[model samples]
Target: MKTMKMIAIPAAVLALAGCATTPGPDELRTNAIAMMKASFKERGQAKLDRIDQDDMQRLCSEYVGEKVMPKEIAQSLEKAQQALIKYPADGKLLGDWKLGERIAQSGVGKQYSDDPKKPAGGNCYACHQLTKEEVSYGTIGPSLYNFAKVRGYGEQIQRYAYGKVYNSQAFSACSSMPRFGHAGILTEEQLRHVVALLMSPDSPVNK
Candidate 1:
């Protein structure tokens, strides 16, 4: 009886140790999310819900430390995102490039202090060299100078620009660019204007 009891005691200890050593993916994800949620409170327009990851966001988060995502996974994510893009009702994809320039320059929305009633800014200049005149710009994204001149002004290019601006993830999975239209950061008209800013030959971007 004593020999049998000793063996069972060690087996029980080993089982307990095994449980303590490994946490599954779901548990780790849940714990991480809970910790993140506890770190911040809702501030005005920025609510706690923003912390919750959608399907694409969660997959992107899973591949964070990797240098490149798996091709199959990336393609799947892009396909899903592409389906979600909402194009303008009218066939017209371009709006006033002048107005588009303003939206691109302004960075005055989506903050706690910013007025909710006012429109959000695309802040395009912050990341891309949109015009030759704007010397100070971020290198995070590629230069957009002579965008239409390089890409060519055409219906297909215009459609690609509009879709990309609406949801960058639709083209590139886990892109740093915001899903402007998908996230409701930009309205349909605002998206059209931004597309014009990139596609219009008369716009400074193309000049």
Candidate 2:
């Protein structure tokens, strides 16, 4: 009985295999996207639209595995991203570092459950060491404990800091850092505050 059952299964499998073809990369990609779309239920501000990748994002995805992003492409992408940074017209990049610290510590905002009426958070502590006093912090990115101190508190550095927080991809293509200002995840004032957290001499990050 067992031998007959085993033989029957392979015969059924062979019959099924003969009728079906393997999916290619494009088909597989389409299927995967469809599966992902079906898997996550849309709710609140988080809709199925989040699954849609922008052109730059799709381009970045192409070279994600076992492939190097070309230097020319990377430079061009960085230039394009740099162009997206809109500086405050007043020419002031600094804000209240104290408020900035609060924003960094708060991980609230930008979730399906989060209240969109409230201002979003930078959540910098989730990926950076912003101060020497922190006993715990994330290390996904570099430690920015002495950001301004190490980089120097200058206009150029300040501009770089604001641009970086606004759109990190401006400096590094395919960076995992969120484009707070560029994406409108954080307001312009919030971007300035976060920049102050990194660039202000009075900031604990500099202390």
- Per-candidate TM equals 0.86, 0.91
* Residue pairs whose backbone atoms clash in candidate 1: none
- Model 2 lDDT tens row, 1-207: 999999999999999999899998778889999999989998887889989987778788888788999999999999999999999999999999999999998889878999989998888899998999987789999999999899999999999999999999999999999988988888889888888888888899988
lDDT of model number 2: 0.90
Give the per-residue Cα lDDT of candidate 1 at 75. Answer: 98
The best candidate by lDDT is 1
lDDT of 1 at 30: 93
Which candidate leads in TM-score? 2
Clashes of 1: 0
Question: For each predicted model, how many residue pairs clash, with residues at least 3 apart or on different chains?
Answer: 0, 0
